[model samples]
Every structure is written in structure tokens, then in C-alpha cells.
Target: MANIVSYLAREQRTFEEEPFNMVDGLVMATLAYLRYERYDRLPARPSEPFRLHDVLALASWRDLLAGSWMRDAADSRSFLRALMASRRYRDAFVSFYVSESSDAVEKQFSAITLTVGDGCVYLAFRGTDGSLAGWKEDFNLCFMDVTPSQQAAVAYVSGVASALPGRIVLTGHSKGGNLAQYAALCVASDVYGRITRVCNYDGPSFLGDPSPRVGDPTYRAMLFKAVPESSLFGMILEDGSDYHVVQSSAMLIFQHEPFSWLVSDGDFLYRDGLTRTALWADGTLDGWLKTRTPEQRAQFIDTIYDFVAASGVKTAADLHRNFGSIVMSVASSTAKLDPETRAFILDTFKALVGVVGRETAKSIDPRTRIRLPRRRESYDGSRPADFARSLRPAADGSQLAEAGKPSHAEPDGLQLAGAGGPCPAKADGVHPAKADDLRLGECGASLPVPCPSAPSPEASPAACGGVLDKD
Candidate 1:
């Protein structure tokens, strides 16, 4: 099925002709006007709302696209180019009240208001950007009751609703969706009464119980949550309001991309239910999270944020590009954690692994029981030939291959991969033995043999020993 861009290009009918649908929700959510570095450059709100043509007339679309942190400039450009040219959205949708803020100590929030047709107004909240602080706030939601972004959303919604006279339709993608729901709930009864629908497109769930106002029949009836078949972010914490599963062309975590969502005839192609992969992940995450106390969860969240911050990258894209360095930073931070906190982190990781292992085991055939082989003492790390001799066939009908050998080759001896001589240096310039020590420490595994402080030149090739030998 065609995606949103294709739908916008092909569909000619306006809101006046076809009426508002999920397709319109997707279009509003895709707006990157909040990412514009200079909001002052744009036309004023309400009194001088900018039409799609007017915004494009400013010749600042390229600058605005470049300023976006969450989406690629090309994608943003393509979407806007399609939007401005479309008969469906170009004339009907006009933007106003754009706001954005990034306060690491407080909150990261951005939103915009759009006038759709004559009587309806669409409040579009931007989702998490590339800011590390924004992501941290999202993780904080796992423990905290109300985030700063949610509070800002409430204030923005209330202020905008009072000033504008129309049937309000709240909409957002990702964290924006979460804000939309929270703001809708926090508004006064009269303000809430003006809201016709609250469309949450793959938004996450609140940590604790929702406000009593959300439980009111009138408010609950206005909620509309839609998620992709293999949703990850949308399935976090809880599945609030009965969610509609939409088909997506992307797989796994990439399904979170709204562009991947399948659209047909200006509406999302509905799926019967969430995909099995989504359910499995949701269940596994929920199960692992249940094993941790509230304090533990908070600590875990803090530790993650601390590590990310320690990397000195402000955006997720930068962090991902420098992942190797970030990992090293994380390892250094892990080493510095207090004994108790370190143990808690390790134990929490082990529990998560156990959950995944159990689920994996359940999916395997009953007749083929799986077990890890016991460590061997005779395996000498120094001798490549002797290490290969200790190899055995696994239950999966595969034999361990010698290091640096072809996958089909039989194990000949214990030798570090890419290590040509007795004492091979790892890619990081550290000795293989020392590198193994760091790996073992990171995994909380006891070193079977003490690692040498330095590589010994005089040591015999047959006398070498380490985790590689035992493996």
C-alpha cells in the first residue's frame, strides 16, 4: 500500500469534501514547523496564520528542514513539498501558535496549532527530537508521575482552547501523542467539552494511573489511539484506550517511523491486532520491569541517562555515530558505580537476560534441550592448535570454528581471532588477555584465570591460558 506522501499526492479532495480522517491526523503530525530555528521569521499566529503556500513563500523551508533533529532534512523537505502542492492540505491547513523549548533541568517541549477547514482546530505536538534530554524525559516517565513536558502541554492546550472558538481535535505522534492525551485530561470541563477527539498516533502510556478526569465517560469516549503492527514505543508502560493497529511497511523498531505506515485511499490500512513480535516484546518488557522495585527502576533510568550524558553528545544521531566511544564511556562509568549500585545493575540485567532466555527456550522444540558446555581447564590460550582440539559439537548440529577460520572449518586449536602470534593485541591495542578481563568484568562473570598485567615475551606458545582457551 502507498504511504502518507503517496496518499497526499494522489488524494485531491479537501476536508470540506471528504471530512477529517486518520490521514489528516498523519499529515498534521508530520509538520516540522516547530523545528524551525527562527520562529519569529514565520507569520504570526491566529491574527496572521500562515497558509501552506504562505509558509513556502518565505523561502525558509530549507532552513527549517535543516533545523529538524528527529527527521532527515530530505524527508522533511519531501513531506513539505508534497503538503504545499496537495489540494487536500495546501489550502485547508493553516499553522499558528508554534512553540519549542529545551531545558535539560526542566523539560523539552514543542507544539503547534493548525486551523483545519472552518470550525475545527488541530493541536499538533511534536514528538521526541534527537535531544538526549528529551529521551531522558521519556525514560523518566517510567518512574515519575508527570513530566515537565506534560505540564507545558496542559498549559498550552488550555490557553489555546480558551482563545480559539471551535471543535478542538488533539493530535500528536510519539511523545507528542502522550502530551495530547495528558493535556486533554488536564483541561477544565468546559475546555474538555470543546474537544471533539484526541488522536494519539503511536504515543506511549503514562506510568501511573491516569487522572480521574480521564475516567469520565465524556473524556474517555473522545480518545483514539492508533499503533503500528510491530510498535515498540507505543506499547511501552501500558496500552491506554483500545488502540487500533495499523499496518506498517517497516520492520521491528523502525515501524515507529510514521512514513512507513501504510495508507490507502487517504486512511491507514487497519490491522486485526498487533503483530506477534510486538506482543512478545511488550510482554517481555513488562515482565522484566515487574521484577524491579520502583527505586531500582529509578536508579536504572538515572544510570542510563548519566551514561548517555557522559558521552557528551546532545543528539541521538551524534551518539549513534560515536557509539564505540559512547560504549567505552559507558564501560568507564560502569566501573565507577558504587558496589551496591553496580550489583543492582548487574542483577537487573541478569533478570532481563533470564526472561529473554526463558522465552527463547519455550519457542524451541521440546526434543532438543539446549545447554552451554562446561569450561575446560586444558585449553591453553597460547597454542592455536591445542585450543581447537577441545572443541565439541553443539546440540544444534554445528561445531565451533577456529578463530579466523572459515565458518565451515573444524576447530583446530585455541587462537584469538585475527591474532597471528602467541600474544595478539586486540583492535584497541590492548592485549587479548586484558581485553577479556574487561569483558568478563563488564558481564559480572568471574575470571577463570587471572589476567596478566602485561604480555610476556618469554612465555611459551603452549603455556597461554584465558577465557578463549576454556571456550
Candidate 2:
């Protein structure tokens, strides 16, 4: 049963399937809650009183600092714990991870291996193959969001590019891809120049072009995004990257898996999709956001920041454990806040859930007009480890191991995988749909997992249920 579940889990992520960002979001929301709860538990006393606004400020700063300073998983967790402890308001909670008896606070790194290069650093969060047994405890607790990671990556690149002027490449799977592109746009020229390519296997799209920092031209040159043809998150927003929609043969949900796209050939196969629907949704949302008198967006940002900071949790893991209770508290308090802001938060929450639910449904069975073979499973049988090994050179291009040349690389070619079931492709190009249009259950039987912070449906196949059940 465990093996079957694992196989299905792997199948769900095959290149043909559309992936959900549920886990990443959950982690972020959980972290927010952790910070908030810890803040409240601190002993009443001392240098400063707890301020909801301070929590907001902390959240804002954390969002801005996610990938900055290049701290791998371990250092990040420790620094955050300490920062929270010292904030006066959280002084009593300062030693949560520390013991007075111990002179030094030991920091723990993720089970994944790290490869640091001259200008780039690569972090491989130990996955199934890695020796990080039980290390993946809370990975699926949240979905990825580029804003935080991009902010950090940009900061990291800015410093590196200034120190060494040359070509640079930023890359990551899922959330990392978004960060790579985001950092490229956020940094200064010297920093961006060092960035030659930004590879995002499948990251959520930007709200639109990044808030142009040093004008628009510089933002356009460095993006190289790719997604499996049936990708869910990859098609979320438009960043203007002519995304290579890979032709995939994977029978199941393929969008979530990266290896599913690796062909025997060294190159990926792709086909264009009717992106108009997706484009429409992107433009609509992005426009609505951008047109918001800066004041409106500011207010919106403030409201969420405040809401999360108020909870005082640290990592996503902390929040997920207690999100239901917290949500109830927020719902109870909503009546006390300004009616307009309260309505906005409630509406936004609904909208977010509806969007994911709807997309997951549609992606699972998009009346697909096209299907193509992405790669043969053989590539993965013996070569996947080797493939990752070659690319494993840290994000900075420092070689981690010698690239084992393949016995024979497959030639790149497109193969049509017959469409399954019903639901013909819509004639309209794949433009973005409105949040309302994205309502789930209107079409599909089951919605993909909702937000990471929310519990998985009780009925979800329990194959690997244990994987996330305890965490």
C-alpha cells in the first residue's frame, strides 16, 4: 500500500498533470501563524508592549528577506527564531530553540546537500532520493510564492553581481523558478548583467512584469521559463516569458513533476497552447492590483500583514497545526474591524480558494486541444539521478560532481499523446478567468488540495497520507 501510494504520488506529479501550489502557501501561512502565536505567548513585561503593527512590520521584513544573505534552510530557521526572541515583545520566547544550559545554539541544516559557487549557490532540499529521511516533514504544508523568495534572491544577486561582474543564471524548481526571474528584475544592472538566464521549471507567474525598478528594458532580457503543457501553476500569470509548454506523455498529473519532462534527448519538447484565457485572467488581476490607488494596495497589504503577524508563528509547520483555530479567531474579530477592510479580507480569502479550486479542476481535464510526448520513462529509469547530477552544480555553477555523459542522448521530437476522457478544448485562447469563473466543483468532482494552510480533504486518497498526517 505504501509503494502504491508513493507511485501515485509520483504519478500525480508526472509531466502531463497540472500541479497545485497548495503546499507552498500552507508553509508561508503557517510561518505567519507561528510568529504570531509565539509573540502572544511571551511573558507580559518589559522593554516594549506587543504591537500588532510591529508584527506587520516583521512580516513585511521577512517577506523582503526570505532568500537574502543566502542562508540555507537551517540558518534561516535559527536566525528567525533568534530575531523573534530579541524583539522585546518576544523576549520570553527568545530561547525557544535554545537552552540556557547550553552555551551555544546549534543550528540544524536541511537534510539536503548544498553546493555554493562563485556567483550562485544551489540548495537541493533532500527529496525522496536524498538521505533526508523524515526531513521532508512539512514540505507540502505550504505552496510556493515568488514574492518572498524573489526578494531574497534579488538581494543575494545584487551583492554578488556588484562583487563579480559577468554572466549569471538563476534557477529553481517550482518556487525557485519564480524567484530566479524575480531577482533578475529586482536587482541593479551590474547584478542583472551577471544573470544570463533565469530557468523556472514551473513557478507561479508574476502578478505581471515585476514592479520595474530601473526601468523596463532591463527586466525583459533575463527570463527563460518552461512548463509542462498541462501545467497549472506555470500558467498562473503572465511574465511575458514565451514559456515552452513541454509535450508530455505522462498519463497522470504531470505538471507537478519536473523529471517527467526530461527526454532521452538533451532538449525538452514543447507545443504552444491557447494562452488567451490565462492571459485574460492575469491581465485582469494584475490591472486591478496596479490600478488600485497605491493606497488601496498598501491598505490591502497592511491588512494581511497585520492579520498574520498578530498570530506570531515562525515556520509554516507551526501555523498549519493550529490554523483552524486561528482562522476562527480572525473570523470572530472581523466584526470588530472596519467593515470595508473586513469585507475585503473575507472576500479575498474566498477568491483565493475559489481560484485554486477552479484551476485545479480545469487543469485536470482542460478540454485539451493538444497533447504531445515529452519524454520516455527510460530517461528517468537510470538517467534521472545522472541528469540531476550534471545540473546539480550549485545555482552558482560550481560543479558538484562530474557530469556522467549519457550512453546516448535522445533526439528532441514531438509525439502526440492521445487525449483522454471528455471535455474538448475551448475555442477561446487560454486567457485568465475571473476568480468567480474559477469556482471549483462547478466542473470537476474533486478539487485539488486547497490552500496549504487548510486541511486536506478527509476523502483524499490516503496512500501517502502518513507523509503529511503527522507533520
Winning model by lDDT: 1
Which portions of model 2 miss their true places by more than 4 Å? Answer: 1-152, 162-166, 186-194, 205-222, 230-232, 247-262, 269-271, 274-305, 308-312, 346-427, 432-471
lDDT of 2 by residue, 91-149 (tens): 11111110011102111111111111121222111111111111121121121122223
lDDT of 1 by residue, 365-400 (tens): 333212222354245567656555435444345444
lDDT of model 1, residue 223: 73
Per-prediction TM-score to the true structure, in the order listed = 0.74, 0.40
The best candidate by TM-score is: 1
Worst 10 residues of 2 by lDDT: 94-103
lDDT of 1 at 48: 49
